[model samples]
Target chain A: MSTRLPTFGNVGLAETLQNRRLLAGIVVFVVLALYPAMTLNAYHTRLLTWIMCFAIAAMGFNIVLGYTGLLSFGHAAFFGTGMYTVVLVMGRVGITDLVAVMVIAMVVSGLVGAIIGVLTVKTHEIYFALLTLALAQLLYILAVRDIGGLTRGTDGIGVTRPDFFGIPISELPAQIYLLGFYYHVVLVALAATIVLLWFVLRSPFGLTLKMIRENETRAEMTGVPVLRYRVYSMILSAMVVGLGGALYAVLIGHITPEYLDWTMSGEIVFMALLGGIGTFFGPVVGAGGFILLQELALSYTEYWHFTMGLVLFIVVLTLRENGIWGGAKTLVERLNDRRGEQ
Target chain B: MSSEPILKTENVRKDFGSIVAVDGVSVEFYDDEIVGIIGPNGAGKTTFTNLISGALPLTDGTIIFDGEDISGLQKYKRVRRGLVRSFQIPQIYDEMTVFENMQASVLSRKQENNRLFTPTHRDSASVSETERLLELFNLEAHADDHTEHLPHGVRKVLDVAMSFALEPEIMILDEPTSGVGSREKNAVMETITEAAVEQQIGLIFIEHDMELIRDYSDRIVALHEGRVLADDDVAAVMNSEEVNQFILEGGV
Candidate 1:
């Protein structure tokens, strides 16, 4: 018998392909980094900052929704819970550090995600989506009704911007750079999150989750602990979204009952779908498109819902089933094929 | 070969609400053996295998693997204990490459699937094992191709190859060539049986193809209406009068 370990010839080729893909991802993020410097407009900066927050949350949602094929309509519950956790921690403990608040939110939302994931991950497809929606609604009602005097009922609460780490706003070099500084912080956080999620999604655990999405029964028989992975994905997804929520709290400087609503959950799902349901970067694109569309529509008329619905309808009808990113990917592939032929 | 059974099921029964799918089917599978289970559509061959593999809850019976009572164990836990099975229809990750499908199975087997930070392709042990299985199954050329795009025969081969990557001590295959082309069926069976034999892995497979079964399996168990109609050496089981009337005569 030969002592050499056997392998397919294409393993090296696959690695090279992955490396190119990684390079392409870095290129995309670097372009994103230059956005603030190019625009320099405070309004655009704030909009992009909010997009960064949504993108972080949406990317986390992609692990469960895109890779794992679990359609969750209750992601906003985690986001809202994260915001609430941060708000409560800031109010009660008087700790105003953004990093500390983000950590607390992640832990709290992660626990909530675990509980919900354990209960609901067993159900497939529509039922899974509905169960998650119900769970989110349960949290929403608790927040709206103020169950234990924690949320201050429907009136909600307001917050002011806290110091960035230990450096106060006055300690900043210039007044114009203060708000932009927060945007930069969000951008940095978003970039780090993308890199982190990229590594995770490329890992074996991510592959297993994708397998579960493709065929749950097959995945189970193949020794993938389906429910466990689902919960883990949910926890990881929730923590990431929770971090986004913490960032959002820092950005908006307020907390409201609407943050915990089922509509918020639906909005996250919309962001994912409007982008592309399956692709990793699609949700972030969807987040940007969604926020922009919402802003543009509301400015034109009060029927922003109507405009958003029309756009969604058009995209679903015209684009590839995978969504915007999938469509773009297909377009690029077709172009590449054409070029190769020449 | 050792007479000590690797996997044994006693009075295994499965009831689908009103009907008994698998009725009191008791069997022992030993190492270095391929047991062919031949039965008609509703003869409960699949259910019997499913019950043994913990795919379905047992209505009434005990499944003992390696001298341990494993009836309560989940399907994945059974797999961890080196009891793995393949599906009738090829089950694979459609979006992933053929190599990735094999790698995922190897990772799951090694219990390194949860290693979030560790890249799967970078795992030297899994990479080597996956490539070996791919090369063994003659799927090296299509290693980088997405599984969804592979031909039916290749997909089936990949599915079985992935099962082998799990390092199953006792692999139960349900119709290894149910949807495969006529000409390619023999090649698929030959590859699988040869690999199992070389690895010293016990195999119990359900098949309608009598010729392939006779050619591959050392022992034959014939089922009729959720009961084992015949169990003997291949020649004896094939020559049995009852098996001839109920199963073979059914024109499967």
Candidate 2:
């Protein structure tokens, strides 16, 4: 038998950063927050803002995949759902309030999610994956053809940033920065969401979720309401992705059917997986890193997708052989132990 | 002997399509008694455990726990009310240590307060209780070890230790010795027996080994083909003509 190992008790935060899952997230958010302070060029600042946009959306996807273990391939639909909800609110009621838009997006996305999730939560594994994808596509088709006037069809709608408390938002950089401030606010919300997720997973309900994920029959035998938790996790999933969509619309200056596309949904999953789902901040880092990688590669050539795909394939293969974040953590611990021994 | 029965299953029947897994079974589980549910495969042992634990919807029966109908309560809700179960395959959280896994259980016990805004880590007593269970389980030395890395025997025992963390009134241990090495089974059973004696919690255990069941259980309830064949003292149930014939026919 192997020698008994030292127990670290419950590990979440130290594991989050030292594992560099949240490390990448911290770097992404900090850089985005400091962009105006760091870079003088307006173009670079906007690019960074776009990076922050995707980062926020990816963070929402992280909440579902990272915390709940539900792989949603149609989060972009939620993103688009949020974005369009905000635009309609802004356009219809002449309401251009960002905070109000964000809240409305959450409620709208949650309701939209409930409508779809009720139909899909009972199915597990690949069926869950396929059902979400189809639903996202169904919404996308509806947004494009059926609700063209409200949604502006496949042509998309011109997303507007109304007066923030009667302050003309578009006329000034600081005002734009205040507009960009929504990302930071969303970041704070995301961070709070992460902490709340930490609490939830540690709670009995969260344990039931993990229990169901690990061993459904065993968990059921233990009296876990599997379908209920499944619905809750998915609804929570929709809320996060929807909030990201609303925040993203402001960042991009427009809302489109592309935001609701499968590619958009697939991107969120990719970011979550790439960042190291072993910890909460893994996707945050992955989203930022992937967006930065996209920026760097796009500047060089049109085949960036192919290049990124290869990179993803390689990392996944390597991660599989070594275990997710397991290798990196062991290496760090070995170093720490050697230092301690010294 | 007490006024309150710890667990009662009232005609709880479950069917998957046309097949009845547990059929109209009524049982009143009392305090301080070790119940051994001895059933052949497909005898609905697991199904019955699930029904009582709120894992499955009952076809027509109510489960009353300490006068509360927990018939269709959520799994976590039942766990909060002190109905904890350990799996046959030992579901220990591999990433956490023995101490952390137990701590999670301690926290999980009060899941309601734990879920609101901030964690109720104000109860310093839980920390020490964790330490006590560590000593009780003899897992003090490797309290920091990620449970996944523990040996099969230690992991299985750690799972039992986790179930005890919530201080449940009743526990269902499903095949606590299955897949455990023959050499390790004796020591594991000793720890299980000791833990049970120390806790004085009602236990419903499923075991295939007649020798082990005979040695530990206060009473044995035998099942064959989803029906109770006998419920009596260990020796009497073991020595029943039906049991003897079943064993002779290689059904044991």
Candidate 3:
């Protein structure tokens, strides 16, 4: 409309800058890979491994929460469902292969996710969030009290490491566990899932999800099927979280009723907030930060909840609109701007 | 031009409780024509356009587009059939760059938005088409800038460019220059008119500004109380006694 509009620079330098940012991301991943070796402590290795599992769940949650603009407080339903599926299949179906168990878990979780998504997609914003939370709590109740025979009720079920293509992991030398072999397996899954998600985020489907996030009406008018895509997103997100959960079951060797609780969903949300909401790999950073803070707080006192609450309050107050990665990104951008001026 | 009608509504009516918003209004539009819809407040200019664009359902009537009845089509289905509409408030993605904004439309129109493995930026065709529209709308400069960071006028132009990227046969703009600066109103209308003529796409726009309506539209459809008061060439509509007294003179 205004020809006098200032001509902003195009993608020439911006593309190069994006590539640099990607390179920085890869460097971070490399460092994360080398972390267990550097720390050389089993506790730290196990802690980091658990952090990876949480990060994976957070990453999956980001599809709905960050990209699609849906705040889901029920992702733990999918996470716990995935782990429970693994345990059930191994116990009832006599599935001994870890991959087969994970595959089944992912499928079962996806079906559950689709059912929940169908019921919830019609509502939006706070209502959608509330519905997801309610449905998740329904699953939690089923796991904890209603389905005691199948789920072991409030006590939960113990998980045994299954064979990997005929190789019995549970019978593996005890030294390997001490050497963090399971930790490396978790890391590999985390890395592979991250790469897959990165591709998805770069895809046209991802762009459409972001468009829905930015403006739902505009997206609908532009020929984007808002409801259908959202359902797909929910299923995909659930699958990713389910996979993470399956891996988590393998890592922890146990599944508890609390795994499906609403608090677990809140923890996932906190992890996303700890990292940048929409930024790639922000959830991973957030999970690590969240876990470290929780561990640190628990070490000092039993009031870890209060300590965690205080830390979250500080973050929300100081950071306001962004998580840790977003804050760091802003700082870097500011530095770059000053450098350009010079 | 073949003179074949690109879009038509027959006895299209919409009622809200006891009040009839669009009372059996029928109009025919052809390709390569710019039709301006002007009316006083509560005249149903927007309501009629909403029905045509599938934003709202018709209480009773039939909408024929390209010789097919599309009265029951959903908004997105209407868009897929090349009947697109731009919002009066310019609904562009605030967080996305201008390039991404246009690319979303381009991708959706191509039915390539479901590809989960291929990166959106890798669609060179959509990218090139988006760039062409941006250049046509004089928005190439802000293609990489986020829509929120751009000026309101630039964002308006980007909104139109994104619609154009959908390759619509007919575009209904609620207000082409409603929020545009007074000085740049001519630029906005001129750019839109020139692009519509160049692409030979049918255009219908709602406006309250008399001068802009008179200057850019080949024909004008004036509405009053949810009914067509005048439908003729711009000069004829401008000279109509009813239109003059009701709309132009602000005499309800």
Model 2 chain B worst lDDT window (10 residues): B113-122
Model 3 stretches astray by more than 4 angstroms:
A1-40, A335-342
Two-chain DockQ for each candidate model? 0.49, 0.21, 0.49
Enumerate the chain B TM-scores of all models: 0.97, 0.91, 0.97
- The docking quality of candidate 2, as DockQ, is 0.21
Model 1 lDDT tens row, A1-342: 122333435567556557887678768767767766776666887888899899899888877888888889889888998889888988878887767777888999999999999999779889988999999999988988999988887888876556656878635654244345777788888888988888788788888888888888878888888889989999999999888888898778778888888888878888888898778788888999999999999999999999999988888788744778888889999999999999
Best by lDDT: 3
Q: TM-score each candidate.
A: 0.93, 0.83, 0.93
Kindly report which residue pairs in candidate 3 clash with one another: none
Off by over 4 Å in 2: A1-32, A173-212, A216-224, A320-342, B3-5, B8-27, B39-44, B54-80, B113-125, B248-251
Where does candidate 1 stray beyond 4 Å? A1-40, A170-178, A336-342
Which pairs clash inside model 2? A6-B144, A6-B145, A7-B144, A7-B145, A223-B75, A224-B75
Kindly report the fnat of each predicted structure, to 2 decimals. Answer: 0.71, 0.17, 0.83
Q: Compose the digit string of candidate 3's lDDT tens values, residues B1-252.
A: 447799999999999999999999999998788999999999999999999988888999999999999999988999999999998988999989988898898899998878887776666666677777788888878878889988889888888888888889999999889889999999999898888888878999999888898888989999999999999999899999998998999943
Global fold similarity of model 3 (TM-score): 0.93
Cand. 2 TM to true fold: 0.83
